[model samples]
Target: MKLKKGINIIDQHDKFGFYCNGKFGGNFVAETARKPIEDLSKLFEKLRRSKKFLKKRDFYFKHYLGGETPFFKLNNLTKYLGGAQIWCKDVSAINGDAHKAYHATVNALICKESGKKFIAGDTGAGMFGKNLALAAKEMKLSAKIFMGTKDISRQAPNVKFMREAGAEVVPVDSGSKTLVDAVSECMRHYVSNCDTTHLAVGSAIGANIFLKICAWSTSQISRELKRQLIKEFGEIPKLKLINVIGGGSSALGFWNEFIDYDKKHVELIGVEAKYAAPLATNAKVAILHGAAQYCLTDKEGQIAETHSLSAGLDYPGSSPLHGLLKDTKRARYTLASDKEALNAFKLVSKLENLRPSLEPAHAWSECIRIAPKLKKSDVIVVNNCGKGYKDKKIYIENIGYYPE
Candidate 1:
């Protein structure tokens, strides 16, 4: 692919060095960079004037991207939990059943602008794959999704959705037969098909350039949350923003605007599955999936096998910015075991009539742990990142009954 003007060229080694006006700009990192849109007024003005922006905005609106999702005040659940005004940002209401729909839409837009004909990537629970397939289909581009065999089994519904959306699903059996292996297979595929295909990374975990793009795309979540909070509470209310972290895109999206908000006003909590809690356990930094980050590894630095009831959270490494947040104490990292998550899943479904994917159920477990101790005046906002439809069969098999 020919390099576009003002866009940096990313080599096969994944070294991202930006160049603008014939001068080398330093490598991009989340901590040092400003938020995506510093001035909303200027951004709106530019969007209004640019034909390309207008076209993309039309596409986004048609597909329900860049729009407000359901923000519910969970009064009954809050009463049951006995503390905090609990609010849930229901990303599951989005078209692809997850926040990843926004990511995939933005990725497709980028590829369309670049004149790419094919979009391909790796997925865990298949949420990203389904989203990508939907976007690619809408854009008249072909899609190929690499998924782990284990994830394919657990996420059968999502796999079927991807195929229905015109994506070719390829099962990967390398490594631990999970996300890491899927990523490896996708990278190899990209190497062979780089000219015609654009890799649509599912998370904020990749080369620096890819991470920057993901963070910028997912910033819509925080922007919408801020607007909704003001409308609901008469102002941006002080609250605890709770999210589950696999590759950290959802957590980053939820907390992006609040990163510079008063730390005392907003406490960011990122929960991980107990079996894949690298950040919670302070694991060593290592290179995985083209980025150096906290990874669960053995004595020889090989990626360790991870298990989680939620296929989405069963990853060996996390986004690099998450490690920075943990190191700087900007965000607190915690873990919830399968038992705790499943119990919260059942409790939330019964009390709230919301069947959240097990990924965000980990965040709900953390909320269950901490909400009771907090004052009633306090607020907690949970990102219900995805719906539980794909995991229903797995849940029934594990618990031996349907959740009432």
Candidate 2:
């Protein structure tokens, strides 16, 4: 497929990051972002260890959601790999049964705290939308979820959950009818509706401020991970953190607490779905969906359409934070084709007796490739980013079965 029917260029020297109101160097908010960018930027700063907000978030995530998520070993897979010890940071048990719950709750609470009655957001595989809708309900706010029509079909369970929670789901039929388009629709709505609606970005992508908000919500994961790691191994071991990166909420979160450690000691690996692998494919640095980051763009600089078996990973752009990491060589990215991810899903489900969403399946695909090469002293942690129950149709169609 000739993307946009133009020459395909690989941009290896591109810088990955964005500026907000001269906050980070070059404030480059898009026209659609003018209204809320400043406020959201301020909100990001205000949320830094603020007692009231942190207390509220803790109540919501702990007593309301569940307690801390479990980080445990995959004994069967570890033994099967026969080299590195493999483990799972299971975010699937989050309140919304996905990592998006963290961002959804945080941003939605931000909305309520700001006295906004409505939350506007977007989703790909529908998990974000579902979680945002649930957050809106809990916070006594209304929600509008923009999702591609194609995603609405594949992610019916989440769509149903969103509507049942009283969120309005708008289906974008244009473009690829996927995540990027849904993101565009949501942001465009923000331009006109910022007064009463807070843009609750459900992942660590999109506009710079939104990215900060999402990343902040997920930082708790890595903090908990640190404690779990110490408890599990008696100390932090030579480890690799591998996770599937769509918008990168989970991957970034999985690594956040450990980022201060030396890369030689704690390696970070990101697995992107093949066609949607901007980091792996060497995408150009461009402003897409309001953030300057590695984007799969046509010659005209317009976002190119991307595809993946996993709806959550289907996007033309990636998180700007990921771009900066790539530029600095702190984190490396790899690609997992749909076939490999599906096969990984089958392998893990049968061996480990766990059902993984397709996104994490991509990480498992990478683990399968590299696990045998590492020494037994090295530990590999793959993030289980979402609940597999939402992928019932995907499992039935691709793998012939969906675990009960």
Candidate 3:
């Protein structure tokens, strides 16, 4: 395939420099040391052409039925912070109130192409599962979403939405009753019925399918970000920071385009839950529970359990691409505690009048604190991953009742 106009070009051996406009420099590491350009291009082409991979979905317009998501301007904060300008990718405008819609829209297309009668997957926060189920139904397929017994309790509202979408919510009562167990069970189901079933993963950290799904889903961020810059300022926005990597898809979406771009000017920082960070503090490169990439592991090489208030970011491992990104210093990974995330969510809601998803809220607050120091004239875009409606219970349980 020919390289697109806006896409960046780089050596297969390089870790970063994969984007169209060189937004992120030397971001993700490339594992293929052999650097056979023809072979690698063929492989990527196979992924691009494979029906099982993905095609575009409808969320581009459906997310904003009325109009494009407004590009939030933070010149006030920019001036206060000295030079940094701030913008937000309003993924909350989507139907499910999260960026999961982007992945779901394409996963449904993949399910249909694979001729799968049933869609099977797992969820912790419920955003991805619900989004996948809705996408499947929209594509005329059946969905079976496996949820942990714990997630069933924590993400009840999302459970209801999945059921309403004609998905069978199977509750796993196994160990932890969290995302890991549910994923193990889902893998079992997939292996048992690989003949007819396809797993629709929400995030890109674990499975190869997830990496592809996320790559396709998150590409929209680049499109929108470019449009926002072109519309607002006469020149392209000088990007200082891009945060959207919780669960890695949204981060991948916007950051992928910048992989080969100018590294000195722009920076890509992925914000994960403070307790569950593969990029921040983890040392080892190992396979995670259901992921095909390198992860943070224990002494026995078992995937280390992650701790986080946001269910979405609680993964023991990150996407292999992310590992590559981290190794190359094309991106910086950071963590935010539950308290910090909750406070960010509250601030965005009060100031922007938008209730962002918990995962992005964590990053948003962190950005708000550091934006003043990063660069005054530079633009920072944070992917507000999802809305906070599904997190109401967790909020009530941890923080307090919503301030009415």
- Write the candidate numbers in order of decreasing TM-score: 2, 1, 3
Cα lDDT tens digits, model 2, 1-404, are: 11111211111112333332221212355565675777776776687558987888898989777969989999899899898999999988777888888888888888887878888999998999998998899888989999999999999999999999999999999899999889889988887888778998767776556787788788778888999999988999999999999988888788887766678999999999999999998988877766678889999987898989899999988887777667667789999999999999988999876788888999999999999999989899988888888887888998798867
Q: lDDT scores for all predictions?
A: 0.79, 0.83, 0.66
Positional deviation of residue 326's Cα in model 3 after best superposition, in angstroms: 0.7
List ranges where model 2 is wrong by over 4 Å: 1-27, 30-32
Cα TM-score of candidate 2: 0.93
Off by over 4 Å in 3: 1-68, 75-83, 289-294
Residue 316 error for model 1, in Å?
0.7
Q: Write the per-residue lDDT of candidate 1 for residues 240-329, one digit (tens) a residue.
A: 999999988888888887876666899999999999989999887777766777889998999899989888899988887777667657
- Candidate 2 local Cα displacement, residue 94, angstroms: 1.6
Candidate 3, overall lDDT?
0.66
Model 1: runs farther than 4 Å from truth? 1-51, 58-66
Report each candidate's C-alpha RMSD, comma-separated, in the order given: 7.4, 6.3, 6.4
Question: What tens-digit string does per-residue lDDT give for candidate 3 at 19-88?
Answer: 2223222223223212322233344456556654522344334442222455677554455546467777
